[model samples]
Target: MGSLGSRVLRRKAGLPRGEAAAAGKGGKRKRGGAEGTGDSDSDGEAEREERLLHLRGRRKKLKSTSKYIYQTLFLNGENSDIKICALGEEWNLHKIYLCQSGYFSSMFSGSWKESSMNVIELEIPDQNIDVEALQVAFGSLYRDDVLINPSRVVALLAAACMLQLDGLIQQCGETMKETITAQTVCAYYNSAGTYGLDSVKKKCLEWLLNNLMTHQSVGLFKELSINLMKQLISSSNLFVLQVEMDVYTALKKWMFLQLVPSWNGSFKQVLTEADAWFAERRREFGGDISFLESAQGSAFLPVFAHLRLQYIISDLASARIVERDALLPSEWLSSVYKQQWFAMLRAEQDNDTGPQEINKEELEGNSMRCGRKLAKDGDYCWRWTGFNFGLDLLVTYTNRYIIFKRNTLNQPCSGSVSLQPRRSIAFRLRLASFDCSGKMICSRTTGYQILTLEKDQEQIVMNLDSRLLTFPLYICCNFLYTSPEKRADSEAQLDHLES
Candidate 1:
């Protein structure tokens, strides 16, 4: 090596010959003398290239073309090629980015009068579309992703549908479906119907079916329209509480709210207020015509027709309420009484054991709907009141399991028990648990099945997993306790009406 002072001066200038020699020797030692300095130098080159590649990747990610384009081009309106005016607001936008929307593309590509214009005025017919929704809808064109807020989804959906933005429309539909609660379900359902979002509409209907009765609310009752109430009552999928009697009771409360929407009160007070209101109506009408036959109630007659009066009148208290309310026409009750009398005779004298097989049509139209709520994870047993054609089925919940017992001699029942050696009934069991917002946390269903039991026999209807068990579980059941009957009675009623 050269003198230390000279070597130091040369090192500062550039890699001198002496320093290169020293580095060569160090590389040989690191790679072993046999491999020489060539392999070591190649390793150094590879490491440097890898470091440069990582730096380039980080720089590219930081730039984020989507964000840059959105901020500069959309927000700053840089070099905008066209202008859009709607809902008393204006936007400076580029046609190239706007073409991502089908509406703008059609306008530009077609032989329309406004195709070549630098500014275009849009007609916004949907009342839901507002300025904020239009801003978000326009901004989404330049951004790679859009964040949807549940509260603003309806308005955004209206804007997207008007602009024919399929991706944004689909996102809005997904957001609505995911956010459905008692407060939002009716609005979502109505918007879905208007926008032709079939999947979202179906999801809203399912949520309503599960929660309408299991978790009733004054807001929901007020929101439910006459036509929607008709649809819900006419379907077997409705989750009724207690029995058919409870369904009529709910309708009476709902009808009261429909008429007196401003009368806000506690849930327990609904029935008392409804009775008082109807009593006033009775006095006004001179108490001669039934409420359902009168002008005010005739509009709801179609909904009431779906109630299985045979099940409702089986209990003395319920029948008495039906008589006292005078909601149904006297002829309506008389006809149901005659039909049920024959059915009772068939069960007692004709040896009608019960339903032998599941008749989907018969069950969907006339099944006895009922439900119960389990407060926590524990052992409990209960029974719904009504004759149930003397089947006397009892429901039990314990150890995360639901059991259905046929009471004959092992357990005392409120109603008469069938003494037959074996009896069959068609049933469908459903259980669900909800979060604070009325969103379903977990749910299960038995669909539709037929179960046969010997005297005092019990069977496991549902086995809950420990992982999925939650407090305040609601269980709803649809039971068809009698065989399907001929349609002669219904046809005769229609015939009388036609005359």
Candidate 2:
């Protein structure tokens, strides 16, 4: 009897019906033959299976019923078709039920001492729920009163993800991406380079690469600041980005271009010098040279920074477009070269015997001497300036001059040297290019003063006799070349500094 009652209680707890009748009928049964026992056992097994199936069906129905109850209680059955509870419930979901009524709060939290509590609620039919009310409620959750504070952006993202609110998730992600600081970005980079929110991770990668490749602020990035441009180029492997030559080329050109307007008239000079400095370091801390090499093809930045700088020697020697025999107006040249001259003259107005008043003869002689200082060497290297085929071929030396031309390409002609000495030595061009070195024969077109003299302290002018000079003539000139002794002394000075 005791065992029977316990069995009845167990069956009653498990199933709501038939347990009392089964217990009342049960007691003892006599043993029977094998066939009868087998038949009876089969019938019992079938009944047990049926009961299990029924219980499973009931549990499934209960799930659907619970979801419907919560939906109607809180969401007003607006999402009646949505299966909200098939997925495991989140911690905040209980709060959702509690907010609906005191009865749910007491039942769910297991604090049911106050059983008399009731809700003053009106039944809202699913169809009668005003669409505007739902819209306004969701809108309140989505609305922004200010630029969403970056500090709260992550929290908003977590909530959006948990709630499956895609729109809010996207908004928070975009806001965080936009407001991210370099420090924060580096932190994200250190931690596998994502916001840890899966939805934004893909979009964040796109944003980060776009910024790395195109943002103006990339120039200010600390990696670029400390000569770590290579790191950016290499670390981009994290994204499997093939660091193309074009991208690197574009980055380098863009960096130098930003400095252009700041250097003003000397933009080209500054850019070239900057490139040279970068090149030296590049070789020392070597990587692909093609990165800098691509700047040659860049069109956004001017190829030549300062037109006045006649020659720019760069890492890549062949990347220059030089105009030969080009003519520039003397006044324009003077404006560029003598910007400080008038100012200096103005300051010297009161002193009669100022530096400018130094005898024109001496000045000319000294300049010619300086200009010819390098002429003693056979090669006579001059920094090439544009040629003037008109009035005279101008070669810039210590002073400007008009030079006489000579014989044809195959046969060389010699010319008579004319030197006039004043305070400075000046050339009065009545010289002849002889056909033979043996005799100084007079060439055609005499008295053509192809050379002229002018005094600007550091500059020289050479006027070429176009009439005498034939095509492909041998012309030699020099400027800014120091004597071997001077060269050695300068080297010593540099060595001293290095030491």
Candidate 3:
């Protein structure tokens, strides 16, 4: 068989028998099988090895070429296709790589005016987009390895957003998540909101909800803008240990900081600064006082507009507010009281018989006791004197009944309150019963009611219901106001009444 195979191989090779045998012996031994089968297998294996080696060489060359291209376009800027001017610095960039961004794609492709230019001048109108951020953003397109830290992530995010780079935006968001803490989150949230980075904004807000009451959170609150503050305070997701009063106090601290210029000290310092500024202005204006009052009132109106006064639990927390009169304007305090009163009245009207009607003369005497006071001692006269919607009234409430007396005080009304005259203020009240575990057992809310006093009425009194006397019961008040246009009209009427 071997001889026949050798002869057949010799014939195919067209070689003499002896010469063919010599060549076969030499090649066959190297190939490692009998009858030359090994020669074909070895040749195939050699071809595969050569192909693999060539492929590896080509890959290395391609990688080197890519590196060279990046260097030429970025580091050297030799033959760069575009010029990006950000924050007064010029960056020479390649249009091909930059075109990966929607911003660059739109500018360089299609019928846009910049498409035809070899040297495109790119300018992001925002001053926050700095050159270093641009460098990081541009570098990331060509390389897989990019570094993002807390310090540079904000600027990079801003630049990436402006450039419409979704991938880089996502990367920045991930970096922000890794870096977020109570101290740094607010700054990141502000940046995200400013740049419209919704993903990062959401994460920051969620983080805030969890960490809002921490000692570190005060730093964040100090830096929050009025609009942001309002957004946070009004958000349903915000969780606080003491929902009503702690939030109110934090809001007050924020507002005081906003009102006082260059204020770095405590809330007391803020009040002092405000007082000094007002006094200085009054003296400067020859004690005219009107302009200063108006300016200060306007400043505070926006701040107070965001405060949810009705949510404040009216027991001990509100009592503290009464003691620290400087924390809120008297008129704001009054609005809070009125809201609570209206809520109580609503609860009573819904859960029990409608308000116990009393003759106007019954409450005529100054400081007349209304319903029987609760057994608990101590002054429970919940008094607040702030404008609510279009009504400017001094409100006082006790365990038995609530009193609303139209405030005739000469203090100028701040625009923060609704100016429209409301025919009546509507509100709801809930009496919550809690168990020993501090969980609510049952809650009863009153049907909505509109409390309207007669034109000649000095005070309107509504009696507390007997059903609300259960131990561990909480009276929750919610106030509803008229629409803005209606509020303006009501405010005008109240202004006339005051005059």
Candidate 4:
């Protein structure tokens, strides 16, 4: 009886009517044969089968009920039971259709003053909502599906969220996620956060992390907010070009743009202008106050705090730039210099043999960030700069094969090379190719692995399929080239107190 009731309920919902029950009844009778409920069981079975086939074929030919309702009831506003007034626009809507939205459902079903009113004024506090968005939101109540444009999604999302339309909000979120690009990512991220769409926000952040260094632009730098910039700069996942020095350079450029919002200059000219501007500022203040100490630059201190100054000061040229700009306070540079000095002593004297196990926290905070861009399909060999605790690692891309070599000898290199028989390094490698809009088209990653190598030995780290290979590919790497050193008593005490 309960099963039969459920079948009846389904039928009322516009599902296939009694077909399953009729087919089951015919099958049971056929199986019983002599003891069948009816003698024409076989004939009934044949009739039911024919009817089911006819119904299945007619489904494609039938006009969608939602479409009919949307066209006549929504588009034409025929037989509207209610008029919703807001944003200087009036929508002639029906109570039944409006009930699909939770906001309206509660108003009509609950004891609300506006429930009995034929004409209600909607108080829309969100500025993102507009008349067009409201029209789409209301129309969605009369339809089963909505086609959302990426450009219009935020406004529609705002309207849908206000009316508590879950389905429309979800569709808008999906559209935003799918359409994210360099131009739209910041706007989408802000909208997603505003609408409490965490997934879309995450997608935007991932896009930013991947392209922040690899596919940089003046427009993108201008669009990036301080909060977003801090998140990207702090994470080890940042795809830094060349080395951490480039990240610093990018930050310098971004800071300059943030300060001089009206400065319209070429990408090549940004660093020069930034350098000149800061130098001028230093001269203006007679080098008495650091840029970060100044009122205007203090707002940016939080964002700059995330940069791995240890890496920046490790390189002579980058350290010189930091010193020349005086954007950061002397204490910041002194502290980093002291920290790096101690680290160098530990790496040089303590015989740091790279990381043995993957400590995610350590990698996230201290891993060396670097990347390379491949323009064509050919043999390429390159190395990133750092003391690297004598770990002279060379990267090679040849014939769709990527190989990593620990160059102790055989290859003339610039920096110190470790002669250890075997040393381990915790590392992550990511490769991606982007489209013109800076949306990642294809990508691959070797997620956090500890690779041990012998002097002058190589390992085939990754193999690429020629079919999946896209030109202008960006390869990013995070490496922990030295094992953690034991904390001194004073440092441990200081850390404990801070915690």
Candidate 3 CA-lDDT value: 0.56
Q: Among these predicted structures, which one has the highest TM-score?
A: 1
Indicate the residue-level lDDT of 372 in model 1. 86
Which scores greater on TM-score, model 1 or model 3?
1
TM-score of each: 0.86, 0.25, 0.51, 0.84
* Per-residue alpha-carbon lDDT of candidate 2 for residues 1-499, written as tens digits (9 for 90 to 100): 9987887886546554454554343321112323354355655565577567667867876676666654553446342222222112211122342333333444545755323333222232333223333332233232332245565555444444433455555676677555544334432232222335543444334434334433324323432321223334333111111122223333444455443324333323543554664565456534443222344322322322212221111111211221111112234334533533332232334221113222333322221111111222122323222211111122332222433231123222232111211011123222222221112233222221222322211222344444543322222221111011234865797799999
Alpha-carbon local distance difference test for all models = 0.86, 0.34, 0.56, 0.86
What order do you get sorting by TM-score, best first?
1, 4, 3, 2
**Order of candidate numbers by lDDT, starting with the best:** 4, 1, 3, 2
**Which prediction has the highest lDDT against the true structure?**
4
lDDT per residue as tens, model 3, 1-499: 9989979986566444455445455565566655555666666576566556656766776687678866776778887767777666777888888988998898777898878876656667776778899888987777655778778888888889888988888888888866777567778888878877788888777666444543333355567676666666555434443344556556555555566546666544544555555456446656333331455545545545555555453445566653343434556667667756654443334232112332222112111111121234222433232324344444444555556544333344442322222234444444444443233355455544556543323453455665655554444443433321235865797899999
Any idea what lDDT model 4 has? 0.86
Question: Per the 3 Å backbone cut-off, how many clashing residue pairs does candidate 2 have?
Answer: 27
The predictions' CA RMSDs to the true structure, in order, are 7.7, 28.4, 16.8, 7.4
lDDT score of residue 66 within candidate 4: 58
Clashes per prediction?
A: 0, 27, 16, 1
Candidate 1 regions exceeding 4 Å error are 1-63, 486-499
